[model samples]
Target: MTGNLWTAREIAQQPDVWRTLATSLDADKPRIDAFLAPLLAKEDLRIVLTGAGTSAFAGQILAPGLSRTLRRRIDAVATTDLVSNPREYLAEDVPTLLVSFARSGDSPESLAAVELAEEVLSECHHLVLTCNPDGQLYRNTAGEHSLALLMPEGTNDRGFAMTSSVTSMMLAALTVLGANPDVTLLADVAADALPDLAKRARVLAEDGADRFVYLGSGPLTGLARESALKLLELTAGRVVSYFDSSLGFRHGPKSVLNPATVALVYLSNDPYTRRYDLDIARELRADLPEGQVITIGCRDDAEEETWSFPGLGHLPDATVAPVLLLAAQHVALATSRALGLDPDNPFPGHEVNRVVKGVTIHALDE
Candidate 1:
């Protein structure tokens, strides 16, 4: 392992990466603000937040909040879907704004989706958020009618899983979408809280379980899916994991609950959403085997291993929940390493690079 590479162990200790990514927002804020001004000013705007896998989830975590904050029509559409079925997702009349988040920006779906949007939509603008400056998405946007924001160096995680890159991109999206009441303050809070968060995650990961379930409501549900996949990917399928909405789980998915399983419930600060999450948590605590439930939230009053975001009020929106997801990723990374797996390259034979593989872009006649 190089000095710059992050072992699962090192990732657990370096909470400062979270802080560094958060604090860097101040410097990037003006640029993001200027880039987004024209898009935000338009009332006829339809924003699409997109990417593949974890990058796709970044949009999921931000879209609901961005929609509410910007008071504009915004949707989290997967690049995979946009690439395969462009007509279903790409509408013609609206002035579209596509926000693409990618760690490497070279993923076939990532780049292809951008090209598809430009080719299919009449009026479309782009905001490319990526860590690699040389990434295809970043390079292609140069001098074009698009805005590109590159994350801090080293954010391009060497690991198969995305940690800092995911959180940083989420933060950048939130900042650009106008969610922060005080950008500096929110960034400071995230920066200060990360170290302690990582420490706690390490402890949790050490206490192993055979299976894991991640639950959330609204936009957080999508985040729950991403979190579950992270553990699954990093562990190379050693740990069986699943994700669903709090209410949706009870329909049939709750049957997977057992003494050997760990259930992670993401509670919302909004009463409407929290009521459903808490109800499920309470039920899980009562019916499931003891010591199987772990709850994470921004509130102070949950019974289980509750994670809180003090000094932060009820966001009433899932947009803010992405900030809290950093801890969860830390836990997953630590757990993967605890199981004796190499976090950097979980699947040696998979042949999937940071960019991706097995894709050929088709040429379109002008």
Candidate 2:
């Protein structure tokens, strides 16, 4: 309960930050329209959402929903992958719009991916979504074919893990890419859910669950990845974590479950997807009753064990995913505090970094 705990403040302030992002985007709608209108109109335009680490996960969360809404090919490729193998993902003949999501925007992969795209693609446009306006990706991407949108101030999280930063960038991408652009609604639902969610998370953290598994369906699977990373990062690797699709968990990943495990399931609001999520949760409860199982959903009655957000049932999986994001963050923060680690800089030895360091970028031609 310290104001100096940047991670806790960043996590708690997300609802309001989300609202402010919505309002700011609304005010700049005309500019957004101008920026996107022509690019969207292009025939066979390939939209590639690229980033590293937590930022890369944003693309994974948004691509499926955005591709469906826009009726175009939108792919989520990690900048790490793109940087390593530019020739595989980028094409010179095809027009490309690379949307880069970065918190600090200075990661080696961020700029390297852009450079590789320029080298290989004849026609390339960049849409940079970053929390830091002054970071390299934002400052250097101003040109005829590139536009960088910085998240409202304070989203650039000072914490070791990206709590507010990733969620805000994901929301910004959702807003601009036309995938359920109701930020106000998402923020409202998140606000409504946080009080009860925080209480549940604290109990879970204090309950001595040292192993965690996060499961989700479709776009929520991206959330699963982020959730796992948040716990791992915040706990400074003290907590072993895994993420998988709800159904996929049984294939092999379920072996991670035990008396010490906490299974966090993010259920999709979609009727079809919810079935798989519920089934997995039920199976986990039946098989590993000693392990704690937590399922988050929008419906009031799916199974006996679920955290229901009844007001948010009407929102799509992509829109409602952010609500569950807060739940995972709270859990991670609580666990970090429980473990007596500084969530702000969980790894002081610099094995990982706030902005990555010590990577030697190689020439693609070499």
Candidate 3:
């Protein structure tokens, strides 16, 4: 295995990066609070989280739990959607907060999404979470109506796949969205589990399973999507990976499992939702080969086969989702290496890009 890949280093640095991010964001809380206080007070404000690709999935992972906790309709509108079809989503009469997430902060759709929000929405405010300070989102958001939270340096991952960038931004969103999750404990759990996780991921990748499935409920559903995308990206599409909610998988997607398939079910912490997740996990374990089906989540007295986040059982699902991703990130990186691909730049031909290109943003019609 190559030890010097930026992807591996980026993946391994997440726990420490998260701790640094926590300290810095906490120090700036007063200003962040000042910026958010008045907007959160408004009952009519529509909160939309927008980003492209991996950044968009970050919003999907955060929206359900945040909306429930905040008692507002928070939508994870992707920048692709916001750019391609702004008229369908943006409302003129409603005050809206467009929370944009970006790793590079240079994507054409990202900038176009912000401009479209400003044009279409009557009362629009911007909250830009980006890793690059020099990116357009960070530089152009100096207006009174916007607040840009630039993550500590090194979070802008140099890898082709987003590793540190995704987790850092998710932690930032949790803190900014008014949840006081134990950031230290989150990092601690990841730190404790990573070494073993890397070993397990290596075994899994080299284990001859060419297909993978990730399933979860609610916030974990999006985490499943993020995990699937990570695997697909890091492997350069050499191995197949798919995602679905636990209940939804039974409909038609369960066929993804075969002798060469490995299925991982992400159990939710919510008691009722956990039942549905367990139902699928048990069924998959029964149907698939032993060790091919695994469960991931938080629990105090977790079963032997389950991968539990040791001390984080009580955190909200959204707050806990980011940490759960470390497992998948490792698996993806390991699989990429096992397949003899460069995790840092998987596509030698540039069929895919770290930051998407060739997307022409068209003007919105009146």
Q: Which one is best on TM-score? A: 3
Q: TM-score of predicted model 3?
A: 0.97
lDDT string, candidate 1, 196-315, tens digits:
776877777887875899999888898898889888887788899999999999899988887778888888777777789888888888876766677777654434336666544456
Query: Which residue pairs show backbone clashes in model 1?
Result: none
lDDT pick, better of 1 and 2? 2
Q: Give TM-scores for every candidate, taking all chains together and pairing residue i with residue i.
A: 0.89, 0.96, 0.97
Give the lowest summed-lDDT range of ten residues in model 3: 1-10
Model 1 gets an lDDT of: 0.77
Mind giving the per-residue lDDT tens digits that candidate 2 earns over 207-261?
Answer: 8778999999889999999899999999988999999999898898888877767
Off by over 4 Å in 1: 2-31, 181-203, 301-305, 316-319, 363-366
Itemize residue pairs with steric clashes in candidate 2.
none
lDDT ranking of the models:
3, 2, 1
